[model samples]
Target: MEKFPQMGGELHKIFGSPESPFKTVSDNILQYTCGKRAECIELRRKLLEPKDAHLAKLLTGIPPSSTALFEERLLAEFVRAHPSTVRPKPRNPPRLPPPASVQPFPSTQPRRERDPALQVQEHKGSWHYCFPIQAQGHQEQPLTQQ
Candidate 1:
């Protein structure tokens, strides 16, 4: 079922990563299941400890202090916790340098504002406009200063 792949996914990821000596999922599983695997035995032993028991309880929505639910909860929770597969992200190719024929612009002039009086400012992630408004038959009213 999905559980097999999910457990395999974490194991497979760790194998490819710096954590495990095995190169593939099948190799890791075969080694663990076949002999008296020290690593596998140690990991299984740790799962019965208080810390892992707490995690199991949290994942299974059982009260943390309840010791009776540890074994069943741990097995169910651990499988459900990890995803079935985690595909590596695709890396972007390096950008090529611009051709020698293309020349860089040497202009150093400051950008000119179309309207000098109408200043715009950002406040608390929102843009505020400081400009005058002219209502019908009313004098030009400057925006209220925030």
Candidate 2:
């Protein structure tokens, strides 16, 4: 006796001829199985805490599961793999005050004295006044005479 195909194949036999519907159902099942298997493999790899190089090598042969259905899973896997804390630092550190090439207009405002209880903040603005600096985007000479 020969072994016969079951499930989808048997269903195909029961439903008139097995040409069109069988093809469609078989394709659908194949796609589903492939996607599920890929997801399982990926999840197992992630849970196992494999090294990056090993994971990268494993990924080379595997085809994308299903462009539409597997996207969320892929994204979740990516997020799980990367983690937000390991993100690169911002290219620009917080902008420091503009260089001494620009100066603020002179005012008779009395300088505030440091209180013993208060924390001393570095006066970034002092650089402009301390040096007779030229205004940025302006060709005008320094406001204070040297």
Candidate 3:
């Protein structure tokens, strides 16, 4: 089989050829040794070539390469620029005054001639009354007859 130069020496030189220690080892070797470290450094250098250092500085406090930082800052600025909401004080219902006019009348009536003869005495917390017979000449007589 014929050996290809691009797939062999040229590509290996550009990506930092493997060290002398890995010279005797097979290319299919999976384990890490001194040669693997050199090749990894070369690859890292190539990958970082397109990065912008100034852009990195501008986004110092933000999460690494994430869009959430811009969105959060924009929302905060919008909230600060807008006017705050005003809430009206709570109002109490109006109180109604008492009625303007009131009429007064007496509850008790005067005793009549034909009314029952009742003798009242206060005993304990209640009033006790005695009823007398309605005689023709005994209308003005005392309730207790000794």
| Best candidate (score: TM-score) | 2
Model 1 per-residue lDDT tens digits across residues 43-95: 65455434445544544453233234335665556547643322345698687
How many clashing residue pairs appear in each of the predictions shown?
A: 0, 0, 0
RMSD of 1: 22.8
lDDT to native, each model:
0.53, 0.52, 0.46
lDDT ranking, best first: 1, 2, 3
Per-residue lDDT of candidate 3, residues 27-78 (tens digit) = 4464455468556655653443324565334333332213332346644553
Which 10 successive residues of model 3 have the least lDDT summed? 61-70
Residue pairs with backbone atoms closer than 3 Å in model 1 (clashes): none
Instruction: Tell me which residue pairs clash in candidate 2.
Output: none
Model 1, residue 80: C-alpha shift (Å): 95
RMSD of 2: 17.9
Give the higher-lDDT candidate: 1 or 2: 1
Per-candidate TM equals 0.17, 0.24, 0.16
Worst lDDT run of 10 residues, candidate 1, spans 61-70
Name the regions of candidate 2 deviating beyond 4 angstroms: 1-19, 50-146
